[model samples]
Target: MSQTTLRRKFAAGLTALATAAGLVVGAPALVGAQATEQGSSASLGSAGSAGSAGSGDAPNTAPAFQPAAGNENPVGFRNWLRPGCSWDPVASWVQLCDVWSPAMNRHIKVQVQPARFGGNAGLYLLDGLRARDDWNAWTRDAQAQRIFLQDNITLVMPVGGQVSFYTDWDRPINLGGNLVEYKYETFLTAELPGYLQQHFGVRTDNNAIAGLSMGGSAAATLAARHRDQFKQVSVFSGYMNPTAPGMYTMIPLAMFDQCKCDPFAMWGLPGSPRWGQNDPLLNADKLRDIPMYITAGSAIPGRYDQPSSLQAVFNTFNGIILEGLSRGSTIAFQNTLNARPNQATFDYRTTGIHGWGYWNDDLIAARSAQILPVMNAQAW
Candidate 1:
């Protein structure tokens, strides 16, 4: 039998899978290309809001869910480029913009997509600290596999803060001394979804969240908290246990050296909440219902494993070993999933690490049969 047929059979057999709008069990007529094909178009259109479309619960902007000409894929089908500007001006695939949250008391630079394949499914992507504002931050080789998402999902890359860990600092204020805190949680959950639909024409319900490294944990947390909003979630090399054994020491040191944050300033020393407040492990229950994908890899000694900026400093701490710590995320992730009976779907790979290569692979898997079924069913 063809791989697509297997996928269909397996998907059909997922009687335990979450409820979806459409499902063809046991070779239920394949629609798009498989992983090797890399380019396939899924059928989709506007769906009603699970909540309210473009309704601002906080300070937010909303986009539209309209599919346009030259883009047949709709939000979930096409993977086209959206133009965005940032610090000075440089042309790039991911459009970078700014978002201000009075609740957070900070101005955040966000990367937005006008529309990918004219589809309505939206994906909020996060970047690691050492990564630049220009790149998507997670899953670097997107240009190649973007075809998979073409007409399949809307890709939104948020230019993650330097060492922000995508967390809303527990402190009363932000790094720049802005008396207001960055309400990332609200922005991501409440505001951002509405904003995407109003501006880009994406249906809010037909969306999911995914990311790499630390961002992966953020994805888990969001999906868990708002499973009603997102149908699927994916994490590549995510931290399942923030307070994992030895992490309190190693993570702080790694942050100090690579992220350039005063350990005292960011986490307020070892016994502080700054470090552990947002670790997904602290709130594993929140992620129990969301379907997820996770992966990681270890570093090669003396080889360029991670981005130079991060790898250089982390290398001092037996970076290879630090890479090994990625297993911690995988372990914690497994522990939680296994504990629950069909809690959430997962794809965990022990062969990769906190780098772009692994992230790209995770993205592919998340977009594959494992995760896309949830996404496709999300269509109204």
Candidate 2:
């Protein structure tokens, strides 16, 4: 069949699937590309509130920070730490904080949902290319707070990092009119974790990390490079192979077009060691023995989505192209790992798109099947 005919058939199939699944059809909203500019400084304010715990207790008004053991630094945590710029009380058990990131030289927000029953395991959720400064799309769009509220795990969702891929850049990039210094790798693996452990009772080791799209690739790279830090990792609709044919150009183009940021500042030139170091496919061997979950879709629009405008249709088309690239890269990474005895779960759907609906479902499934299991383990 011709390409157009195939797409129509796919859409019809999705419509049937939607009908069978009882999905509510809705106008297509921009999944991860809604935010146009970075966040500006503002005094912290309470955005919303939730119940105290997963069991529906009174909202907990207890202080979130305490001087726990090993928390005190000779330099003092107060020297650079600033908290409570923004708050989202998901429940009596869940709270989000905007903390100043000294490494990135700016304030970044993290959703802080304390683990139920005092569990020490933490889960970090990373966002995609057009990550907003106000909140991670996971919480704002994916209903992630509700998904993990009852679980015995701290949910860490850092806000903002548009087109950053969450990596430690060699130099600052001009984003729109502002020069952004992206040191997300350091903030996540070091500064943020230390803060969580000291103040929130989150454990540094045996943590779980997951991300979608740009964040997904970063999750894999970070988990592999910092194997001692993360016990489990998941990547949904991520570009795993950075050095694949046409990827060097394609990636830069995507980054530049999204936020007017130079991709070269991210990891040096295309053939540099940084690219190889960050490529999850090339570093697949480093992920051995770590429980991982990688998922992607064919980029076909699903039944729950409807293109209501020309911009929506264009955005949907763009998502298709980007997700198709990710699917191909993830499959290649999966095949490379087949050569070795590794523990990884691959979820490649024949139909779907790189939208919030699929990613939300993926997060729920990964948390239940892969993340929680490894986290609840008695030993690593």
lDDT of each: 0.48, 0.67
TM-score of each: 0.64, 0.76
Count residue pairs with overlapping backbones in model 2.
6
lDDT tens string, model 2, 61-122? 12222112332222222223224633464443345676778887887778676665556888
Task: Name the lDDT of candidate 1.
Answer: 0.48
Q: What value does the lDDT take at residue 17 in candidate 2?
A: 32
Please give, for residues 1-380, the per-residue lDDT of candidate 1 as tens digits: 44454444432322112112122123222312232111111100000000022211111011222222343334442234323344322222344556565666555566654444455767777655443444443323333224343345566676545455655555643434444453567777776666667656668777778765556767777776677677777776666666765456545443433333343454466656655556676666666666666665543332223223322222222222333455545676678667865445555443432344445555665666455577662222
Quick one: how many clashes does candidate 1 have? Answer: 41
Residue 73's lDDT in candidate 1: 39
- lDDT for model 2 comes to 0.67
Where model 1 places Cα greater than 4 Å from the true spot, the runs are 1-94, 104-107, 114-117, 139-149, 172-181, 262-277, 298-319, 343-350, 377-380
Error of 1 at 338 (Å): 0.8
Query: Model 2, residue 29: what's the lDDT?
Result: 30
